[model samples]
Target chain A: MNQDILVKAIDVTKNYGHFRALDKVGLEVARGEVSCIIGPSGSGKSTLLRCINLLERMDGGAIWVNDELIGYRRDGNNLHEISDAEISRQRRRIGMVFQRFNLFPHKTALENIIEGPVQVLGEAVNEARERAMALLERVGLADKANHYPSELSGGQQQRVAIARAMGMRPDLILFDEPTSALDPELVSEVLDVMRNLAASGMTMIVVTHELGFARNVANTVTFMEAGKVVETGLASEVLSAPRSARTAEFIKAVHS
Target chain B: MTTASLTSSMSSTAETKYEIAHLRLVPKRHVGRMVAAAAVLVLLAALVRAFSVGQIEWSYVRDFLFAPAILDGLANTLLMTVAAMCLGIVLGVIVAIMRISGNPVLSSIAIGYVWIFRGAPALLQLMLWFNLALIFPTLGIPGLFEMRTVDVMTPFVAAVLGLGISQGAYTSEVVRSGLLSVDSGQYEAARTIGMTQMLMLRRIVLPQAMRVMVPPIGNEVIGMVKLTSLASVIQYSEILHNAQIIYFANTRVLELLLVASFWYLAVVSVLSIGQHYIERYFGRGSKSIRSSI
Candidate 1:
């Protein structure tokens, strides 16, 4: 548990019935670093990322964000499970962008961005609107502020999702296949937003198959296989010339 | 060169003629079948006309349908319908919430409500409420007060209670389906942004669910509008019952029944058109509607 680590998962394990989704997984994400988790579908990469934000509760393990254990608290001899409300409160510190964008369709882009700030942070509507406008501008969707998610293109919607997560001023943001749903031509726009966010020193845990983006923007790359972290190191080491045989196979499979 | 151009044009024209000769247009047999079907329908209509046993008194039809008493009955019918609808919608929202509530007891209660009312016939429910005096001579509120049995169970009271309660059950299921039609991810997204459950329901869930629920509930409204006629069986004197009384006195049963049918048709037609516009309003922005599914 290094003090520099913004998130640390110690031997985290998650089971869905007989199948283990995450198996004794341990990882650390340092502050102000972009870490990308790459694996095939059902390789537990997305599940691991979800665990960081307590979106998917672990069956066994301890998760700490800024050294605060999530999903549980001990009082005397009793370990009281955290309520959903409490979990929601903790989730505010770590925003998540879903694969489907999950933008509130009933809300306009500007409103979606401001919703967290106004509702969770208790900011005034005017102040929330101001910050939302600035974030929308940053995401290059200032013109689409009043547009609903249905009206926006998939890439634009993902950008709005990014802006919505950023609205909370979270310490770290988790992206679960953010650009996977976008058209091939539109993928780069969302990846560009992520790259910009990474450049701005935002701590991020991105689960993606976009090897090129991982090589360019990610500071660290962790390759997962069958619910285990098979390789972890600098992005170049993992992406360019991986030491592990599984990593090499995965990279080759991705390339071909 | 002009002679060569004329020969080339003649060759192209000959090719067009060959293609047209090979084309098969509509078959003559299909037209013959259509005419045979039309002739059968005409024969059936003629047979029905020949078997006419009695004449309908047009004057009796006019009197029963347009009389002031029957019109008043129609007004009462409308009033009962509107009141039941308002109550049903309000109850529906509550029950839908209960069904989705985290508390098991509340959810089960909602489930039981939908089960019992929807399981039973609406007519049976009306009869049961009309004869509720047999069940409870006096319904009392402890620490509050009580009223006489007859006073507490009037026909008007019975009709509203019966119809509204029954409608609520069906409406709840409709509303729940609407709410469930929305993605659970929407709720999660709203909560992640820190909106309270109340705010989320009001701003996010209900508006979206309403778009899904409007058509079904509009169908329910039309159904309930006709269902009000059943209340007349308990001597509530709705449009149909008033027509029955008038025609029985005049011995013009067919005319009176026709009069009632005409009114029902009129109301239903208006409501059907209303339902269309409402469906259209919510259909905007929906992908399925835009694609004409």
Candidate 2:
């Protein structure tokens, strides 16, 4: 119910058959705060981020975005699953950037950026196109606007992906290891864009392995392990001086 | 530019270290390729000579090519092909979607439909449709209106239904494979962008699927052009049937047959050209093709 809270997940759980992917995961991200979830593979950091935007349905508990419960309607003691249209509408408030970039290969970078606005939000094509160009410029890809995803370098494609996520004017963006698929040299370009996005006061929930980006850019850092939040605190404290042995060990492993 | 740079770098390295002159490269010649080319040319010439000198009246073939009966038959063949293909493609897309749907009943129904139509021979399906009056006797609503099955099931109607329905079965599989060829990430991207399922399919998925689907669908269309001849069994009056009728009367069987063959070849060649352009259109933005201006 806090007005400052942009995204809140309480006791969220997800299961792929018998294997629990997320177990009682709870986190809250305030408006304009960049929160990064860091852990090893299969720790459910990505799953938790996915559940916050209703990309993966939670088997237990609920998620709220600005006091609005997502993916279901609660009436008295019963929960009615929302329709696909309703889910789609709710998803519009949250944009996601994938590790693979996942740009529409059939379209130009500019077209990819404008698709969400023109197609889903019914914004005018001309206006959407104008805004798309601006986003491309912001990501330093104005020259590659007409280039398809296949024509761009890995870093450029990821930057375009960021521009695409920004095109919809979402209140918050979820990034799932946005630079993991990039080459080592290409990683900084994408991280630089994310760093700028953070500096611009855009609320972001990033599941990433980029420890340096987390240490510098993220306001709050949450360490997850095996579907549970192992540690959550200020970025400096968690990365430099952790309370739990698990967080300290993870930080050590990542550093080494 | 890269090749030029590489050659310059190699020359510089050779000059600095090995003191070796740039090697003079000679292209290798394969005697077997030369022999094969000569053999193919000779075989082609002999075949062309045999066809020209064969026992056939060239004048009859020429005269009958554009005869009234043959022209009408050609019209009927083209019409039937277009009608059946339209029906088949529409039904094929629907069936393919159903086959991939989450509902068990719809998926199973699509499976059964494909199994039945694809399992039977095209000729057998045509016979069954042409003779359907024997089973139904009458069709249409029981109380509101009714008509004799024999009257409703004309050869044209029967042929279209038979060929179109069978074509739908094969096309459904091609379409399904095409849809599956799209990456899962594309679907997730569409979802994150807040696109409805139908909207995503139409705007995002189907266009990408077209690249995979068009080649197979072109093969099917070309196959359908020749398959229209099978309708002659039910007297649908296509090109082959008209050719047979003329030959039966004039006793110029080979000539009429040659005329029919020429038309079939001509139509299929034009269609092959058309298929090439369509493939090019869908191939845009793919790895092999350069971006448009």
Model 2 DockQ reads 0.65
The best candidate by DockQ is 2
Please tell me the TM-score of chain A for candidate 2: 0.98
User: Model 1, B1-293: lDDT tens per residue?
Assistant: 69999999999999888787667797566888899999999999898785464586677776666889878888888888898888888889999999999999999999999888878887788788888878677778966987766677777777887888889998998899999999987886776665667878887788889888998899999988899998888888889888888877877888888888898889989999998887766665565665774
Chain B TM-score for all candidates, comma-separated: 0.84, 0.88
TM-score (C-alpha, index-matched) for candidate 1: 0.85
Model 1, global lDDT: 0.86
- Residues A120-182 of candidate 1: C-alpha lDDT, one tens digit per residue: 788999999999999999999999999877789999999999999999999999999998888
For all predicted structures, in order, the TM-scores are 0.85, 0.92
C-alpha lDDT (0 to 100) for residue B115 of candidate 2: 99
Query: lDDT (0-100) at residue A241 of candidate 2?
Result: 96
- On residues B1-293, what C-alpha lDDT tens digit does candidate 2 reach at each position? 69999999989887878754686878999999999999999999999999889988899998999999999999999999998898889889999999999989999999999999999999899999999998999999989999999998999999999999999999999999999999999999999999999999998999999999999999999999999999999999999999999999999999998899999999999999999898888777788754442
CAPRI grade, predicted model 1: acceptable
Docking class of 2: medium
Cα misplacement distance, residue A59 of candidate 2 (Å): 1.6
